[model samples]
Target: MSTILFHEIVFGPIHSRRLGVSLGMNLLPYDGKLCSFDCIYCECGFNKDFRTKTKLPDRENVRAALEDKLLSLRREGITPDVITFAGNGEPTMHPEFKGIIDDTIELRNRYFPDAKISVLTNGMHLNKPEVFEALQKIENPIVKLDSALDKTVRLLDRPNAPGYSVAKQVERYKRFKGDFILQTMFVRGRFEGKEIDNTTEEEISAWLELVRALNPREVMIYTIDRETPAKELEKVPVGDLQKIAARVEGLGIQTNVAG
Candidate 1:
């Protein structure tokens, strides 16, 4: 049941396995996790286990805090490669997400214009006009799509929305029009007794079809790298990840593997 939670509005210039020198922004409450999906491999743990009593950080507070952090980094002669929106939960869930992203862009231009702005979202909120517009403005909008099958999505992601489905998710991602990055987590495990693995032949074949249809700017295939709330989960090997990357590369799309 090990989990990691960010306690500050803007924390870290931590080295990311994929995005280098990332300065993270947490729009969710500092006290707990808030997400649309309760992923089995989430490092933030189960939502029920980390409920928050505090409110989400307001737009002004987030702007001020991020500006201060950017100023401090400038003073230290450190330039982040990316200012990432990956906090306690789904960043797009924040009511003021659009405004915060606008502020982040402004601050990044003023401090480190070379740095990219990225938001790691579950892609559930894309239907929201504000979320969609905000994501479109960012340099890296990494959307998660764990499986091409509705059953696997239900078993793995445990999305809170009753109407959530693989078809709808694909449609939501299609709105990006090849502008977004598709991120998938490959894992093998048993949750509550059912076997779960997205690396199977059937899984990959179906997933590949969707990949071809989407034709994203890049495909990011990764496995669990931290202690997950569901102890039964196991990481997919780096070699396997590279093999999968090869299949994606065959489509003439850029791919990155972080196992």
Candidate 2:
């Protein structure tokens, strides 16, 4: 089985396909993966594979580690383009998520005022008032909307909530009021005995309606770029992604294809 990708609390001034040179903040436990979605294409592999006894890093530890990293980068004259909250799991699920976001904002202001603060989330916790407020504070609230159909979402994202539905998530996403960046991962695959593909015309048409309703500032359409826990999946090519982007752009919503 594929394993968790990041092992440290504060990791990477790595090049991100979407966020540019980013410094990552991992609020989840370093030894395990804790997430709301069990995406077939997750780079961190399957959630069940990396369950651990390690605890989630506290707000104080996250703040201190981030500050230390920022100070070190400053001393070395290295400036990152963004401070990203993405690691082994759903970052907003952190118990003190709002406080952590506040701490991150303060650190960003002190160390790299020009750097954008971004949170890459699966959009599960947006129903919570505090999560919504915290996401609003970030420069890039890149929320996921992999599929518009509830059946497709169940197959593609495999959300942890027993009663999770696409309609409810769309309503939660509307709370952003065009302030958030909409991210979609297009792929084709088979999980268990079922075939899965979200790049179909029917799927894209339904998705376009949701994009229209949400009116996001930007739409990021991309495909699988790394080894996934599910070995049967196939990546959507750049040409196809560009074609999808064109269709989305036709709706008057700016779209970027990460290929």
Pairs that collide in candidate 1 are: none
Q: Model 1, 16-54: lDDT tens per residue?
A: 999999999999989899999999889999999999899
lDDT of 1: 0.95
lDDT of each: 0.95, 0.91
Tens digits of lDDT, candidate 2, 19-76:
8999998888788889999988898878888887888989989888999999999999
In angstroms, give how far residue 160 of model 2 lies from its true place. Answer: 1.3
TM-score of 2: 0.98
**Candidate 1 C-alpha error for residue 119, in Å:** 0.2
What are the clashing pairs of model 2?
Answer: none
Number of the top TM-score candidate:
1
